[model samples]
Target chain A: MPSFDLDSYLQTQVERVEQLLRSRSDEMGVQVPPRLLESMRYSLLAGGKRLRPVLCLAFAEAVLKQSNVPRMVEDCACALEFIHTYSLVHDDLPSMDNDDMRRGRPTNHKVYGEAMAILAGDSLLTDAFALVAGGPEPVRGVLCRELAVASGSSGMVGGQVLDIAEDRPAHIDYLTRMHRLKTGALIRAACRMGVLAAGGDADALARADVYGDSVGLAFQIADDVLDVTGDASSMGKPVGADAAAGRFTFPAVLGLEESKQLAARKVAEAIDAVKTLEPHDGPLAALARYSVERRS
Target chain B: MPSFDLDSYLQTQVERVEQLLRSRSDEMGVQVPPRLLESMRYSLLAGGKRLRPVLCLAFAEAVLKQSNVPRMVEDCACALEFIHTYSLVHDDLPSMDNDDMRRGRPTNHKVYGEAMAILAGDSLLTDAFALVAGGPEPVRGVLCRELAVASGSSGMVGGQVLDIAEDRPAHIDYLTRMHRLKTGALIRAACRMGVLAAGGDADALARADVYGDSVGLAFQIADDVLDVTGDASSMGKPVGADAAAGRFTFPAVLGLEESKQLAARKVAEAIDAVKTLEPHDGPLAALARYSVERRS
Candidate 1:
């Protein structure tokens, strides 16, 4: 119905990426900070779509061979996921979302308590870079730059600043800008990094960046839609929480009908962005559609 | 003359370091998140021995003819200090150390509240890597690895695990080992990074690491000594707070007299570690003495 089986394809690729990341976690089984490592795993392995890492992998495959990034990619993807999880953990704290449940389980602060939740989030964010930092100097250096750009001012964390400020405002421009940085920066980085890790070309990187940016916006809008118009049981968390926050979102600003149309337009742009690449056939095509159409 | 003129030397260097950090806080300038950036400056400019960066500069001179890190040094040094300050902020959070004050001001969480404190800490930590990432790839890569090792499980964070787990009672050897990883890891990384940044030889790196390790332990003991013997006035924070938390220290495990003796021995080892370098004098020697004796 959506011109492709988005769910099965995404689920398959996401599983592959998750399995790869899980392997790296096993290898990083260092001794001293056993509990620290355990806590990291608790948050990391908590099930999600693995969307970010798969995008990284699928993009890298456009340039690199499929099997080339077994070790490095896992750590890179794991670090990104850690950043995402840490944000969710902190954002759900009483001072923020006051969410008690996530991924159908107790939120980190709920399970670990507020203090541990705070510390756990802190450690995960710090360790995200540290995870990549332990590698060879050149690769680690390049990877650090890639990740720093993704996570810093012009990237995900910067978006967070705008997002919090938007809780009161109703401006569409501010909302788009916030969504660009908050969600788009990391997703773009993940795509670009996949190329970097696998020695992809400049052209590929540029195209993927465009694709990732478009889809990142589209994906967040989908989130807004699900939040307002989703089923609680199927979504695994509260659906209308965003509206309840009286916060900015696509639907909040553009109305539900327009929000859906905008998401589809962005998805179309993302698909067209990669259409020129001959090697961009499999996962990349599937990914653009999945970004817009996935239910969860 | 109290063996060495540590007070005068420390005063000038600490002031210089604080000044350097404050000015560079604005280097990323108006684009940075205002409150988050201000919080970063608040902690970085807070007075302390600029031991980490000084060690960096010392090792830079000791390893090569640079005499000082280039203009870029300030940004990177301040970045390292930011990482340190962020760790302290998070460590002192309710989930971690639960300390109420740091560097004479209400700890970040106390002033900004927990959510901001957590985000502030996350901002600093991520931005630290962002600074390095944006720098020259080769230098940034090596520096990133050095920092990652220090910040992660094998280092400071790992030491933190040992700190909390060892909070009750454990083998003295275990406690000491934990402290080395926790505090010593980053301090050692700071020195090692100066060499990496300067493109020095293995021999210089080895000496710096050894010196850093010994001085790191001595620094902790001086902290313990101050916890018991110094005042809240000079220290700028509550004294005897560690004992209240049931955390162990050199004085707690060994008597005050024995702790002082051990401190002296560690200092001797630190001095010897760096003495092999050609033509060593001034700040490095003064720092060794200061590490064992600083009141705050």
Candidate 2:
């Protein structure tokens, strides 16, 4: 297997995702309300790990047997980012988590007011489908279906509903199910979309699906751990928010040590799942491990 | 032109739409949170004119030269209604219009609480695309793109932003543009999607586009006029909401008499635009006239 530098790979792809998002927002500037566009840009352009888009592009590259990302791959990546960003924006609304800060800056609603924030989130979600629909016709329907299913009622939004209804501590089974729908669905969809965009065979998609599911669960566990262990300044938001909100979390259900152990086990399983892709999947393997180990 | 029973036609199709919507909601009930599903069902199954879905099916019937509505056409129609209903739910949030009632009952947020209402709206909007993505492959991409563009920032959401920003009475041009994006875009898309679903040729689609545009503008003008002239009991919501909200409106910009006159002229133009469809389009013509003439 060829040596892979995960940091460099992420940095390069994150830049591409950022540039595409910025340009797309600019393209929409003239057509949308100035404040609405500004609110969208504020949240979309705000810095994050860009993990979903990177996972999308990386999977596409692996499936296509190419070193360079294809144009359609970038479009799919941007769509994933848009959906993820919109979810975050809506999650931070006063009616939801009511967070004032994200990425160490004021949330979209805090800056643009509640109405514009809601509209901005709505725009981002709608534009995501529009972006995917603009891709090659052969895969447009597939991509659209993947995105819509992952982000819609039975997926992200349903998870949100479950989360908000959590007035008491939840069982491990309930927490797992909630996280699978809320966070795992989008992550898994991002992986599947990359393979679909590349027209990869069913076997390749199956492998990617397993890899995504394992990694998604591991990622949430790691997030839960970080919320307990990390500092507010480093996390770019208040630490222990889950505890403060009295929300169900991995660490809450399984103690911190057990949560860490479970996350490690899931990451190992994710890496093993992707081993079939071998030489071309170095970045993916690295990503799975990074999910559980990342400080932020 | 063959005599058309607009009332009976609307009655039967609306029944079909209501049944489909109910079944789909039930199908989703198992997967979604109970409260969230209730909120979505509350708004989606609520009684309304069902005009958008009806327009969609009518155009498809005309284009296909068939008396029966195809399943995909009905699917597209339902998707249009879903988008429209979601917008109304979100728009009624305290952060937005703060409306307490809609369709002669409490609004979603008023009944289900703010967080669940927001999730319900988000789920509905996302599911609209999911529903379209399930349509026939040949038209799925086209339908998805049209719906997304019509409902996205550059369309409905953009119009909403413009609407919310109106602290003072807006000029005619600004108000026109706002209504075009807010209300007109989805109406126009409903007509276009109907043609697209039927695999109508370019000429048919072009003619439908013009018909939709004229009717859409007329519909909004009529709505503005009704806000001033109609009763709350019949309209299903309080009248003069625009005035109470201090928002820019067609009547505010054009005055009641001029707005009424413009709506009549547009309805005439809309009827003229669909004349090429002739005998099969009688229902459509009546719908155009009704846009300006309906009591609610």
Candidate 3:
């Protein structure tokens, strides 16, 4: 097992983010859509690792150890998860994955119908910006530019759009492009924005971003491995679902042995990326190893 | 039968918007998602009366005759239409209206998958900010503030969210609340933003907002009327679909007779609201009358 205490790190960040999302989100006149807000909250607070935002906060704090970093980081962090979960919600809809199960429950659309699911995704994505716009003005532009690029066409949206449309035979470059934009953008943003929020730690942020990119890619590759070898009972979700969907996964293209070698390479790269950072973020370095090496 | 030439006006705006949309929306670096951009363009260029953005620009030019407005005004105008069309695209998705037909073609999700459709909506919506953010510093703040409110929870997204989850029988207040937020907020922004972009007289901007509120409500009322009476063939969508969806609409609560009366009253108010502004923009006042009274 990796030596990282990410679970504890996640616990503290989740509490902080929950408070931030609740206190900061209220507006003066508009009554928030209760169901939408409730649904978003349920997904966000639903006991996941809180990896994305925690990584963001950790990366930001690694170099510029200020008290205000956590104070200012929640909206951006939670908003990343909101966008991620929202995509998951819509992606699982019948027209796409048609999966009834997610994190061991029927997906939101299955419970709420398609319109609410669609709108939930829409609301979550927009609420992300609204959250950023409401943040302190200094970092607002940087956050907007990064998050928008990550979430919009150039990043996650672009990758997913191509994922849906592309019937071409699998290529690493194409899949890597998709992975970096779709899954990796927000992950990388979490680190980069964290550093930015800490009031300009460019070197630390760049290092964090390297860690993020390598880990994000390794995370995907590990999932492809898990889908190939993971047991359905232990995986929570079905195993081999990606293969069933005819997805061009790492193991499918590279063979399991090659995929494992690539995963190991990425884990080393992710760990090495942040070697220059001080020992205070030792847990984060361990996280890089866990990302590629985890079985479930 | 309305005095103004609605078809020709709509045609002119649509042509201009289509021309603009075909060009790349200038972003700092991230490549525009090919499918998302293509989908946005497909819907943006899809036929609709460019009333919202037209109102924005026409009033802007009418109010601020300072001769300093940049071509970005045209882009802002195009941006409003993009926002409106994006909402419609998402609203028409299977998870929402589940309608296959929109403007006589397949709805975006019907053509693109649900994930891409959601992203396309998200892309277009956020891209509106990118458009406004590109403007001069003076106007960007006003543009950002106004667009954020209109597009965010207090405005369109909030209303649509409520409309989807209201779980109520057809109720007048619910319908009004939904319409005001879902449709009226953006309409109000269209008028308000036009004046803001032009740096128009403050009083004129307020009056234009009043005009927008009235015309916007009247437009909804007319849509409700069309829901009962329009030819699906000519309307290019399912006319009685609202009733089928169990949605609370103006005509359902007001009764057809009362709904028509209310629409006419609102149209008169719209005309009255804009009449304060003199010879500079006779066309806008004329257009409001035409927008609510159009048979198609």
Best of the candidates, lDDT: 2
lDDT of 1 by residue, B1-296 (tens): 23545567567656767777766667754566666666666766776667888777767766666555664455566677877888888787876788888878888778877766766777778878877767775677767767876776567777776777634465668767877987888888878887777777898889888888888888888888899899999999989887887778888898799888988998888888777664545567778887876667
Model 1 scores a C-alpha lDDT of 0.76
- lDDT, candidate 3, at B285: 68
> Every model's DockQ, to 2 decimals?
0.59, 0.82, 0.41
Q: Alpha carbon lDDT of residue B189, candidate 2?
A: 97
Q: On DockQ, who's better, 1 or 3?
A: 1
lDDT of 2: 0.88
Tens-place lDDT per residue, model 2, A183-252, is 9999999999989888789998998999999999999999999999998877998898889877788888
lDDT of each candidate versus the true structure: 0.76, 0.88, 0.74
Report the lDDT tens digits of candidate 1 across residue range A184-239: 88888888777776667789889988988998999999999888888998789988
Q: How close is candidate 3 to the true structure, as a TM-score?
A: 0.87
CA RMSD of all predictions: 2.6, 1.6, 3.8
What is the lDDT ranking, best to worst? 2, 1, 3
Give DockQ: model 2.
0.82
Model 1, residue A58: distance off in Å is 0.5
Write model 3 residue lDDT over A79-152, tens digit each, in one string.
67767877788677776667888776778877777777777676666667666656665566567557766776
lDDT of 3 by residue, B1-296 (tens): 34555567667666765666656354422486555777777787786777787787667767765424566577677778768988998887765666788888988888877667777887787676666655665565456557767776667888888777657557777888888889998999888888877777779888988988988888889888988898878788877888887668887787899999988999888888877674523667677777667766
lDDT of 2 by residue, B1-296 (tens): 56777778778888987987887668756788787888899999998988898899889988987868767887888889999999999999999989999999999998998888888899999998888898777789889999999999899999998888845345888888888999999999999999998889999899889989989999999988989999988999889887887667788888899998999999888898888885745888989988888899
List the candidate numbers ranked by TM-score, top first. 2, 1, 3
The alpha-carbon lDDT assigned to residue A114 of candidate 2 equals 89
Candidate 2, true inter-chain contacts retained: 0.78
